[model samples]
Target: MHVLRKAILAAACTAGLAAATTPALAQTTLRAVMHSDLKILDPIWTTAYIVRNHGYMIYDTLLAQDEKGVVQPQMVEKYETAPDNKSYTFTLRDGLLWHDGQPVTSEDCIASIKRWAIKDSLGQKMMTFVDSIAAVDAKTFTIKLKEPTGLVLLGLSKPSSNVPFMMPKRVAETDPNKQIKDFTGSGPFVFARDEWKPGDKTVYVKFDKYKPRPEPPSGLAGGKVAKLDRVEWRAISDAQQALNALSKGEIDFVEQPSHDLLGTLKKDPNVDIVASPMLKAQYVFRPNTLHKPFDNPKIRQALWYAFNQEDFLMATVGDENYIQPCKALFICDTPLATTKGMDALLTSNAKKAQELLKDAGYDGTPVVLMHSTDLKALTNLAPVAKSLMEKAGFKVDMQSMDWQTLVARRAKKDPPDAGGWNAFLTAWVTADVMNPVSTAYVNAACDKASFGWPCDAQLEKLRDDFARETDPAKQKAIAEAVQLRVIEYTPEIPLGEYVQPAAMRKNVKGFVIAPVPVFWNMEITK
Candidate 1:
């Protein structure tokens, strides 16, 4: 993500493909069911993954990314960052209208930032790092930062990142905290309605009056327009029930079914299989600094020797060991991903692991391994890991929990203070973006007073340094330092990186598996 904004270059295509006999799906309603809902409704207030469903519908980021994860401009026509990097100037395009027919302006965003930065009325804590927001003119605005935040650009570009999303200042500011309901946006879709329920279902209707993004980098073909008139997302308990609906053509699609269904769907001509690599799987480990045994770097290093991630990926997905060890925090694709410490993190020497525990005087000591994952893409790897860790003379205890519970434990300071969790295994969704940005979301101590772990002042500084850094080499070095700091101190362990797969029915036209799924960009063609 760039410090600037999205340039809505109408995406162009070569020509048309063969046509099918299917009905025109745009006007037809599309029903989709997911395993769960993204929890928060207002993206600015919470970093909860589920909130994105709402964000994808009403809010529009200044920049939009392409399939290759390249940052492209959106609502913004152009912009520039100050030489010092503390301030960013953005120029908005004229005549963009919100759903209520109000002119979208810089003033709207300026005011919205003020609310999201410190007083996101819902009490959601995602924007605690924002410094300030100010407008220079009707068409221009500036975002001031606590530090030149490196992830600001990418954060802004995410489907629903923690940063401030623009809203019409007029209506929202009127009662500020009273109603807290404003459905106005300048994006491709407008808010139609929602029947909200926690852990239930929600429906969103499209704004027919929505303006089509201009030509040539045709936004729709490139996935910027909301092709369907409406989308109904349900929370169904049974995969068969959802897939049954899909096969009977009762629903358009369903997400995250058991592996057994993959074959069943492929054989059924009515339903097309949508298989997507979930995204980059990050290897997170607790550094030796957080607890006793892990506090010893030797024991920490011994972990790499204990894990057989490749074996795990093979069992989970043969030949699709697409989930491989990251080698380091900064992957090859991300700009300035810390490439150091990966080799140490991915080691699998059972004898050496035992020697490390012995040298550190922690041999045979039991350590807790908390997992938020439901199924190991590589189940076999667990036994291999257990054997290696046992060979190394360490007692491993494992437990599993739902994602929300896991988030509460990791982000909130509750039990597990007495090293209740010696260490944990999980993956990060870097999505081919820089590690620093996503890494923070996964492990950074947002508010030290509240988080269970002691804050690393060095990481805080690195976060600051990476933000303002302009020189690529300097930024890379800083990023590497951050990765090394995390690796050496291990609060969370990193095991492997994964690629999110975007599988759709063969008839699902313009389907893409972006880091965040965008409804406006999809179409069903036959």
Candidate 2:
């Protein structure tokens, strides 16, 4: 493993040297090392963060959340909600045009929202209350709901994965289950498809035709002024080499630096580490409930008691400064955060796990754990999980693959041995899982649920109740009930929480600090 890492770093260093030696372009271009290689371009098809980031570069949203988590208008010039909250009318801002130079219309937004609703958890919940979504005119649309609910604007303004990114009607009409070939959007940047090389680099050129909102940029809610002529997302998988490149002026930014290397980067006066509380995430362990032994909830419960939160946190994030031992399903320090029904399970008890396995009539089916070796933050998780599960008398078969491959493979519903997965580890930004409706993994909607396919009708009902109840006290009570049901079902385990900091050269300025990275309003200075 050490030798392979060394080889990767060596190659990256050579590439950095080449970049440094190349003649500088006349146009201002910002070269960045993103968290992962860009492979999948269709954000609606998968909940991958990289793809969502790509979506933000090329597509606009109807509304967006500010730094304070307040939803604000973006593409929508203005909107009005009826007193009953059963109807919402939205008018698109002027000068919105697709990459192909066609004016963005109400029909386009409606189609985009419908497509996103099919795949996003929050969108699905919001759709349940929606009666009709019709265009009033070229630039105006109205959504009529069967009942009053706050999920309409909230779903549209969701700040993270599976974001409702507006696209041309032609592109938006594509089936949500399939990837769209069209890359047309009306955002700040235009995707340079011809320049894209999946494993090496992805390119984007600023869309000169895009009109920035008049409001000052706040989180992802306001103006997205593209200050750079071009942006290049160069794939440098090695953390040390990426930082070395940044220090030497080969690259301007690194989306995620390895936790242990922060001190070294801090010593370099040229590099700046940007860490935000909104950037915190919760690592999760999801068991595929479609196949045994996970199909049996009791068997799933056995492993719950076997694993410890602190072990997972320490194994993945060695830096004590970045790690947090949290058991809250919703996320610690949030309004819905709670440790209800987690008292006995947060601490490891192999003996108790073994007893539960016996009570569940275990047939010794091996759990197929998928390990994403490409992502630095996720590579250690499967090994640690394997050790903990084996300690509890569970047979484990660990499979290794790149993060992109794992993202594609996790969607399969086949049996474990038939190219399907039994369990996998992934993390979500706090914004993605802050509440019952927004938490994709917590949705127990049977076939409609996120990967792992865990279904509990009662749990689904509780989530619906939480979404419907508006009273704060009543909502808290319902949220606790939902958390208790999640504990009882074990749909997904909340391993722990940690912060991921982004490092960049001091010359790269105006970077947004939202839950997800956005390249707008940023400029490169020589």
Candidate 3:
């Protein structure tokens, strides 16, 4: 690993030297080192941030959230909800065309929504209330609800996880479980499918045919103005090498620099580091309920008291300024945020945890914890988790792999020895978890639940009630109840929250300040 890194730095230094003498290219291009390699392309199939970023590069959404968290039309020119809130209507904007030159139609949007509903927790919940999603015309579609539903707009305009990225009808018709082969989209950038080499590089060109909205770009909504002619995503796994490349002008941006290296990057005059204006992301520790030890709620709850949030936060972020100990299932500072049952769990009582583990009949089986080593943010998580579990009198099997491999493996249902896992740690944009309506991790539906598949009938009912309840105070009350239930059942562990800042060259202007790091409206200059 050290030798490979040295070779990369040597090549980067050589390229930097060449760039210093050579004049800027005729066409503008932004070379970026994203958080990880673009292994998955279908954003609906997986909630991986790499794929979510890739989705933004090539696809357009019917609606999007702005910096203020307001939902605005993107593909939809105009939309209206019924007085009774039973039906909603949307009209497609003019000049929306797929990269292949096919016109964007309402049927395509309907199909995309249908495919998304299969795996997305919120989508599945929203669909239960939806009577039908039918096209009124080529440019218009209407969603008729079985009853009065309040989550329609929020559901369609959700900012993350199964993002409602509009695709061509054929591509949208692909099996929800399977990846799509088509890459056609009506977004501001056209994905260069031919140039895509999974682990090395992924390229995108400006969509000349895309027409920008009249409004100024805000968050993921409004005008998606492509300021650069081309964008290149280079996979540079090593943090030090990525920083070296950024400093040498070999790369235009680093999506996520290592937290420990932020001081060095900030000292560089040519580099500009910026944090997302959105809320800080939360670290989630999910355990497989189908497996041994963790299947017992008592054992799961014991981990809550054993695993110290501060330890995990310090290990993962290393900077106290950018992190906070938040025990809420709905991210801290959000409307649904609560500390109802976190008092005992967040205390970090190893003695109580051990007592609970003993009472739960923990059989001393090695807990298979999947660890993703490639991601700098996640690399230190497993070690911290392992230490805590061991201290709580449990054997742990720390299995290491890349983020993409971990993502794929977490979906398996086999026993630990047969390839399944006990637990893993990951982070979510605060927006994704701020409410039960959009939070997949909070869904307690048995086989149909998110990754870990923790089943709790009462928790599921509370979530459903929270979704249908129209009163804000009632919803908050329900959220507090849900948080308490989650704590008691122990589906997952909240390991605090932290902000991840991106580093870029000084000349890369017009970068979006949204939660998702978008390349649109960003220009690269010499």
TM-score between model 2 and native: 0.95
TM-score of each: 0.72, 0.95, 0.94
The Cα error of candidate 1 at residue 212, in Å, is 4.6
Write candidate 2's Cα lDDT for 1-526 as tens digits: 4344334323432332101111133267899999899999999999999999999998999999999999999999999999988899999999898766679999999999999999999999999999999999999999999998889989999999889999888889998989998787788887777668998998887676789998888999889999986789999998889888999999999999999889899999888899999889999999999998999999988877999989888888898999998888999999888888888996789999999999999989999999999888998999999999999999999999999999999999989889998999999999999888899998989898898987899988987887788998898888899888887799999999999999999988999989999999999877
* Per-residue lDDT of model 3, residues 1-526, tens digit only: 4344334323432342101111122167789999999988889999999999999988999999998999999899999988988999999999998766678999999999999888888888888899998999999999999888667888889888889889889899999988987777778876766567888988877666688899999988889999876788999999999999999999999998999999988999999999863837899899999989788888888888888789988998989978988888888777888888777776668899899989989889899999999999889999999998898888999999999999899888999999899999999998789877678888888887888898999988887798789899999999898888888888878899999998999999998899898998899766
Which one wins on lDDT? 2
* Cα lDDT computed for each candidate against the true fold: 0.54, 0.89, 0.85
Score candidate 1 by lDDT: 0.54
Following a full C-alpha superposition, what root-mean-square deviation does model 2 have from the true structure?
A: 7.2
lDDT of 1 by residue, 1-526 (tens): 1111011111100011111111232355566766455444455544444555566566665666665555566777777877866667788766566655556788887666555544221112224345666778888887765655545556555443443466778644643323344556656654433344545656655554455446323221243567766666766656567677777776776655544455676688766654444344454444324556665666666676666556545544444434555565655556675557666445566777677677878845566556554333323334445555676678877556654455445543323445355554444356523545445332344343112353556665666566556688988888888878766554455555655343345556655565555577567776
- The 10-residue segment with the lowest total lDDT in model 3: 17-26
| Top candidate (TM-score) | 2
Candidate 1 vs 2: which has more lDDT:
2
Q: Which is superior by TM-score, 1 or 3?
A: 3
Worst 10 residues of 1 by lDDT: 5-14
Model 2 off-target regions past 4 Å? 1-26
